[model samples]
Target chain A: MKKFSAVLLVLAFSAAALFADGLSLADQGVFSAGGIVIQNDGVFDPVNGQYSTYGQLLHADHANIFYQIPENSNGHSMVLLHGYGQSRMGWMGTPDGRDGWNDYFLRKGYSTYLVDQPRRGEAGQTSVASAISTEPQELAWFTQFRMGRWPLFNMNSQFPQDEESIDQFFRQMTPDTGNIDFDVIKDAMIEVFDKSGPGILVTHSQGGFPGWTTAAASDNVEAVIAIEPGGVPFPEDKLPEPVDAGYYSVGGIPMSDEDFDALIEKPIIIIYGDYIPEDSDLPAERFWRAGLEMAYEFEDLVNSMGGDCTVIYLPDIGIRGNSHFMFQEKNNMEIADVIYSWLDDRELC
Target chain B: MKKFSAVLLVLAFSAAALFADGLSLADQGVFSAGGIVIQNDGVFDPVNGQYSTYGQLLHADHANIFYQIPENSNGHSMVLLHGYGQSRMGWMGTPDGRDGWNDYFLRKGYSTYLVDQPRRGEAGQTSVASAISTEPQELAWFTQFRMGRWPLFNMNSQFPQDEESIDQFFRQMTPDTGNIDFDVIKDAMIEVFDKSGPGILVTHSQGGFPGWTTAAASDNVEAVIAIEPGGVPFPEDKLPEPVDAGYYSVGGIPMSDEDFDALIEKPIIIIYGDYIPEDSDLPAERFWRAGLEMAYEFEDLVNSMGGDCTVIYLPDIGIRGNSHFMFQEKNNMEIADVIYSWLDDRELC
Candidate 1:
């Protein structure tokens, strides 16, 4: 009882001190940079002073960055990249109204740059227009995300099961204003790093593919922490047979040896969550299982080439009950600590 | 020099104290509510356990609110609605990296809820599809927003003239994933008020029309502070002739007498920025001038009905050099102070 009381007092003091001397919302800075502005060729109407649609500047294809630097800073920034169908809101906080990785890392002294990638979320403007589909995707995504079959959740899932939480989770799924063009994504992401300075790339799911490419393209990405990256990249010489995971094939992208070598220059960590089976009837699990297999292969390839890589299977480390979205799970802080420890070991924190 | 030094010292101490005890970003809460979920009627594939496209849930037509409540909150929330083509980012800060109305109101002991209307910004999902136009609107909007003609800005404009600031400003414009349906927006705004409880609606340009209707529909909206409202609401019996303002019309919405009566129950203030000429060849200025004229007519209607309504031409009060987006200008804090004073007079702060 006394120990519990002491812990409470310590927590209270820490909260008070954090409120007093650390970063407040008012102290943070928010802005955007990167992406090319395409100027259309149109003349202005002399009589009305209105530029024709062709003459206007199209400010499309940029990453919108919302960042905060704490007073007691570690001097390193964590550039958070969201997954497919998600935005910077995913990294900001959880659907359950709890502190997300944004707050956790800030409290731990690292600045955060939550990004809304090109043609998605706040960066919805695009050079090429795509039809924004209104097809119902909530259930399809919920099942595909490996949370559980529709109307039933994984028994041990850490996702908040309240109605409101589910509503919020569904609401967070955004449509692409433009097609998911890899080249567009890469250019915008590279610009984000160019402007934000050197930072660690923290990517989730689909963002991992571009994250790898951006890291190879930009010297600013110091390291990468991929949370269930869709797939890693393989050098042309070492292409593995694509795994036929239903709905989509689990195949690593083929890359040039030069790009592979550039990627190997940075230390990397790949994290996979629970409920993924070695072999299962479920396509979601099958998909991740194949991706996990690629992760080990990539890890081995990197280490053989005098590069460092770590692949962590959460259950192996006694951290379980996490779906694909481990960062938003109930034990999110516990998972954040694991990444912190990895960063510490690499002397990057 | 001594007075200047004293002022600096006082400012320094205030910053320190604010850092110590006031609301930090971590202290704020963010979540979304009030969207209808459409369940598709399709069967799941028994073989793969995948739901058909028709079987998933479509979560659409909602307001996305990012809110902050300070430790010294005034107990009343101020709901901020952005202008056309913009999002909640407009109220959060300036493109030049200065505090916006969100920070100012938070500091003044009022909680703020920055909203992204249905089919806009954070709330991008919708029931109906709208073509996200890629037509360069930057220059056209620049002229239409009264920020001076493109390639040439007003000499005394408060807008940040730096290239980076202009880039940032252009990047802030977002596309509507769905069509701009007022009914959809009204429903979503009502949901926001329902969830956030009673509060004042602080609206800009395009948001003002919906703001008035929403206030009438939802009893929770205590008051309204409209900045350069595109148009006011007029009773059907007293409808003004629609003004022709070139590219579009500047006409107040026709409302039922009961709706108008309901609106008059709440204290309202209308603010118009500078650069609006009473007679101008510029369509943008002409649009606003006609709207300004309607504001007085609406004010007279409200006042005659024993309701409170104040319309202020910014230049009339010596607050000049403001374009349409006064909230994001260099003197944003000064404008915020004017708003605070008004709220104080109404016993709202």
Candidate 2:
């Protein structure tokens, strides 16, 4: 098992110059939030024989809508993606009944669109085996996200200790019914990308898995903010299964020169937080650190291919004591401010 | 999203009196290791419409052993189950190339048995789905384990900082092939328990899933230390598939009143660390926190059934700065000291 070649965790330096963000200062009429139909196509359920629609067609995935359509609406619209076993609700409210990122972003002035993956949350239905599973017994938020050591080892954790908050967070989660079809997710998201017009995409966790490829699949995508992404394109001719989700291409997937050209200027920022172990004893920590290495390698890959991608490690920048779910942390607003500033510096605002 | 009833993260208290432990300090000759064949059975291969042995029957789950005869051993033995994407190597060596728990436990005088699950590591072939998948991108360790915040927010962490150490940790990881076949894991582990005689079943991460059920399946198991368990019984008639991984019975599954009595005297301790969040903004953190709630409920269930299951939160006891892989951490020896004392308290060591 001691076989792989030695690797390093290097943060690449971006040489691109900053630009003024084109955020509209003028007051506008509509401030709205809604779900975009990522994949509405259907499959030939052999049981049903004839091809049906994705929802009626394949019996998978659903959505919602609400907004002030901000009178001060900036032309910039952002897409919000929840992690595995979750829906759009996560971006709207915290488990502790606090203001979630969705509202923050809305107030931040970006028109936000949230998504529920096929067969989960508002997404109607899908197969059971391929859906997301939090079935793992030992690894969860307490351990995986680094909120704390877990099982209430120390009640002094920064996580909201109130019972009501915990309950609220727990109640909003939704499980997957079948295997995760990354291709389907990409297709759906790309569709949303086209329907919603080119804007910035913000993805978290499992959503980050598809986020990379979806960014590459569409010309409409201006940039991507992958929050704690699960998989980045593994700098390979053929991107990995879950990353490509059986798709022919996505960001980082080796392709014809034309595809690579399309990826140019599609600014991508892979956001990470503190707690990625340098040499912790836990396999979970080690495994996570391994994933981050892939992302770093990806930054190198995308840059080598002439794509614009930057890696933002919050800890490196001075913000500390965050779990994986930093966006919803008590200090999430502060973290968001950091991200917002970066976007402003890059003129993505 | 805030549509749920209030809940709590409760740490159950036990009123049992303390007792002296009976240990054997005799010097034994010839320290050795071997694997226990948990399953040597045949199966019907539906694809071939014929009967075939499970990975050649004799090649079920594998385990290591010590002491010419496990039964003749000095009143102490241990069976170890590694977390997701990990094998027995986790117990023998840290990813950073340090002395791991395997050697420590061996030095502590307990005959240790290490297991590589069916189709995982050295256990040979099994279902493709149940194999390990490194697809999870951001949430596993950095935030989930609690070393610190994620996305490069902070670099100051307690993880080993040497490059060689970091390289060693990344090299040993194995990826999953198909969906995790939890039932297969449970069967293999239970068989090991019966074949090796009752001893302490120590589990980490995903292995904790089968760990709980294996304990329930075999009355031979003297005690269990489920470290930062991901899912406990959910207080349901039949445990959820991902939770129980589709086994007929386990915690959360109802049983005959007589069968419940079999759980008596099963001293179980669920250990956790300090990083689990109190008000994380990420759904990954909340989802994980929810899993802890289930474990808490399971403790309540086991206790009401007369089982001695105590949740040991490390931070609460003044042990902090630990990650999910406490067994392999730099201060693992300290954590082990705590587990060792607990085992001694129960006379299981």
Candidate 3:
């Protein structure tokens, strides 16, 4: 008991420290990268267009809102989520210093807030860097792969000479490499919601898992737009055990038919890449068919418990490129447009 | 024109000689690898309850006609296409080597044929090895990251030095760099189809694209089970000009949409990994999104055009460690079950 309590205290301290060092929405460069003018309310620099840092975004006394108040009001707000290893910067249209989703949302007369969730994006980067510095050998696989070294067996060969070597190579790439603290993230989201009120939550990839978990945990969330969300239970009879200890658990994380029932009551839109296979060379037919089945199951489960849910499938919107990150693609605007239209039509915000 | 004709003749002669000298399917160990058993055939030795060579499965003429059995009283026929740089051995299953899709299908009373497509699998290895005795520097980049090497710049920091560098790294991963001849593949498929009649074409990753292309070009392809078919057109607006001289090309190819329409009226089932994002953290979101969107578009378009198509999304799957390649995972049986069930339900013989 004492050990558990001590661990909790350390976790709490780390959480507080993370908030203190967090990057603001602007300092995180989400808006500036999208060419948006930050309107500051004296706390952070709004004159030079620099908004709050990551810490400020997490612990701001007031809402650090960065949006365009259109002359003709659409009375709508657009929220965007980034995938794994990404921050709110993912919603900001282009990472290559071009117009991003934020500018598009603003231009469409909708309020946009590219929220930087704790333990992700700039914060996550800090954590990863710290981890790498502290555990060089632990991160050697990732580093080696990034540096173009042969970290695993050659996949380009017809028959790899060493199979066990390849298996060991991939055992590494997990998120629990002694870097991120999930408690900090949960608290940050709680704080942000307490201050900002509920709005639409649009997430991509792993971001969708947290978004779903948080939404399920809170009633404040209005709607969810999941672009390749990654957290729901798999269709297989047996589920994979949870790897991460936080909200994104693969284990039976207590999400009941009741939780899905409540979730479906809220409007949820899913957009996934259709070209990916469930298994290698195995077409995604079963998995996707299972997803649709799951959607129906979710809807039925929710409706049975007095909740209304709607699921939409956007086929072939082109999210896969060389690297597999959807936000970095050239047609992010199309994705943004589809999402924006969905939010507007639903009026969830 | 005369010089071109002479070159073509010389190439044809060389290709014939090479094909003659090349390793037979038996020499390449297909029977043992694919778990195929030929009854009443004296060409192969069945030792210790395992077929020793593909000679039993091969016709007297060394053609793949054994797979073209006109009628099976108690079984059906299934064809498997491996991913890039893989061969029939891939279908022989993974680390344990106890479960390949071919065996599963065969055990289910479906005769299975593992195809060695042009420019991929064993064919590619032989071609590439013959073409360049020493591994090409280009090939180094393909396997470097997998081999625990950083295929990019050496930046010690966790965050990319800048977004530009991240974008550059992702860009390097996109170019097409394989020596497989698509024309040769198409011809081979045509030859096989001519003898085999209509059958289900199962493809993974890069194999999906060519599978779809082949299905769209041939009338004998009854259905396509595309496992994570990569390279579908994304963001309808950004489609590239088809380079090959084919009916699907925008400018060069003789095969047009009309030809595809005539050939492909069959069902297409796409199976994809649900948790994996198609892009990495880079400035290619639009490109990736385009790919995703295009995959969806392909589904809808094909269906709208009288071809039945479906996309299946599998959960808890990633690029490595129980993801990416299908034949490697322990759940390959479940994957096979899904494909077989889909085929059975559709009544596609």
Candidate 4:
């Protein structure tokens, strides 16, 4: 016990330094010489005048960090997008200090570009008065990802059990104090695609929109792997009498089909986890289950339009018990293997 | 967008059935009737002459539910305990509707008893003025479980993106307005053993203490599977020059060597995830890393005392990317495979 306390005492003092500024990417040892560069795709709002305290409104812009090819590069250049309450680090670490997807893929020879959406992470901040929605609370993850029952978790949950892991995961989750303009994020994504060159578009959760939006707008996009794409397009249970007036968009706000062409050449697969409609009475579970059904509707529409889209429910492929964060789950490597297998099938990787 | 809206409209109405008081065990088809019952093993406080609201403190009480075996059961019985803010359901179902640990074990022929510590879950409630801490907020899960950076998340994070999942996980999480009465939980566990006969003990997170506490208090526990047991004992970086008075414990309180004997006959294994110092340099991550070190110290101590205690780091075993919640992860079955393998090795199953 004395020994333990001593270690604690020592760490207590050392912690100030360790946490002072956090460990930046300089030590990540990920990029080769002349392979790393940081740029911004957004512009300062300046609407309120350059001198206004709120004038900078960092709202209209975003920042991108590009990790260039390493010595034995595989020529696989991909853009990595984070999910809600997360930044690039979400793609870098597993909370327990394991290799995040960015490094995993980078090691595999991929030139990875991680993006920070406008007003998120390093992009800058915004105000609730000028945004689309209020900063979200710590509630959405519980149900959408299927970690456990809402309000109450299934002790058998696949989510992490370590308190520090849990605490860390949440600690880095910077709340959106202001609303995010999806269009800005989409534009930033397009900018990333333009700067990074067409490659595989890897997106998780909310990044799904920006990924799809970017891919839809760029012919350069080679393939799209939408990991549980947010706001997926699903056919209505009943077709409207007339399909002319409204636009159906995967991204929020109605988008017309005429606005974008079906992704014919791009091999797209939307992957979701195993348990949906968990055998519980929670409405959240049911809603999620129903939402997932849309992936099928989307597949049919794409296929009808002569586009390439495949919807994969991990369970059907023998991968079960996956929560939304399967990418970072214990079997992440296995899942990556599965994804890589798909890439191989499509000859993308 | 029209199609999405149409589908949304239909689902909005049909969702009623989909979410109606989710289908539980009666329809779960996993167990037989007369198979489950609840019992308490501690006393309630009569602080106000047995009539005040605080009079029913029940600070020293814990509740346990016992699931009897079915005719086709494997004839194995086990006591299942949950982590912080969790109860029986934590072991029963995935938020997305997959089988929980309870069903998984029961199907494996192990009758299970899910515990609700005093003032937690179905165990009952307590007054904040009398407890150890405040009720948790909706934000805790964001980091604690490695779902993503708290408040904000990775657009690429696999944590559920939908609002329902988030809301559901929290709704069930009853904060500890008061402190957990570990002694009560331990007593309850002992009673479970008395009523159910000698069996294995499967504990997660906060339940770790009770599992250990109970084991220390009784010889009925045949084996122990401490899943990410919190407050694990750690080996001192260097033993103090003078081994003075003090104790090392997983929980905050100090424990003494004279208090318990080495779990000589009962084989025990503590399971931890892949990342400790998750790549992100968050203090929370460091804290978790420190905690995991304790597991090694614990294993060393138990083994030194002629006890069979092993520390299984999943990553070392080729299981990677797992957060704290391995038992409920996507590869849960695979993890279970490993655990079962150990059990088989010990001839416990």
Per-model TM-score on C-alpha atoms: 0.91, 0.41, 0.33, 0.42
Superposed by TM-score, candidate 3 places the C-alpha of residue A68 at a distance from the truth, in angstroms, of: 69
Q: Relative to the unseen true structure, what is the C-alpha lDDT of residue A214 in candidate 1, on a scale of 0 to 100?
A: 89
lDDT of model 2 at residue A140?
39
* Residue-wise C-alpha lDDT for candidate 2, range B1-349, written one tens digit per residue: 0111101100011111111222221221111111122222333222231122332211122221212122224556688887775545567545443455655565566766666565443332222334222122222343445544432312334455453333233223333323456666776566556545668899887787778777777876888888877566433453444332111122344444443455445788888765555555544445445555556777777787667878766667887766676776677778888888898899886
lDDT (10s digit) by residue, model 3, range A1-349 = 0001111211121100111111111110011111001111223221121222311111111111122233333555455545544334345423222345655555565546555443222221121222211111222222211211123222222111232222212211112112343333444443344323466666765566556665665566678777655545322333444443211223422455555555655777766543333332211223333444454454454456565455544344433321123343455566667777777677642
Candidate structures ordered by lDDT, highest first: 1, 2, 4, 3
Candidate achieving the largest lDDT = 1
- Model 4, position A160, has a per-residue lDDT of 55
Is model 4 an incorrect, acceptable, medium or high docking prediction? incorrect
Order the candidates by DockQ, highest first — what do you get? 1, 4, 2, 3
Model 4 segments more than 4 A misplaced: A1-60, A66-68, A127-140, A150-157, A234-254, A259-264, A278-280, B1-349
Judged by DockQ, which candidate is best? Answer: 1
CA displacement after TM-score superposition, residue B203 of candidate 3 (Å): 1.6
**Candidate 1's residue-wise lDDT over A1-349, tens digit each?**
0001111211121111113322354255456655657776666542364756546678777777777666667777789999999888887667777777888887777778888888888788887899988777677788778888768788788988866677777888888998887766776677666656788899999999898998899898899999999899999989889989867798778989999999989999999999888888887778889999999999999999999999999999999888888888789989999999999998887
**lDDT over C-alpha atoms for residue B346 of model 4:** 82
Runs off by more than 4 Å, candidate 2 = A1-68, A127-141, A152-157, A234-261, B1-349
Q: Which of the numbered candidates is closest to the native, going by highest TM-score? A: 1
Task: Give the per-residue Cα lDDT of candidate 1 at B321.
Answer: 90
- Model 3 residue A227 CA deviation (Å) reads 62
TM-score of 4: 0.42
* Candidate 1 ranges with C-alpha deviation above 4 Å: A1-26, A49-51, B1-26, B46-51
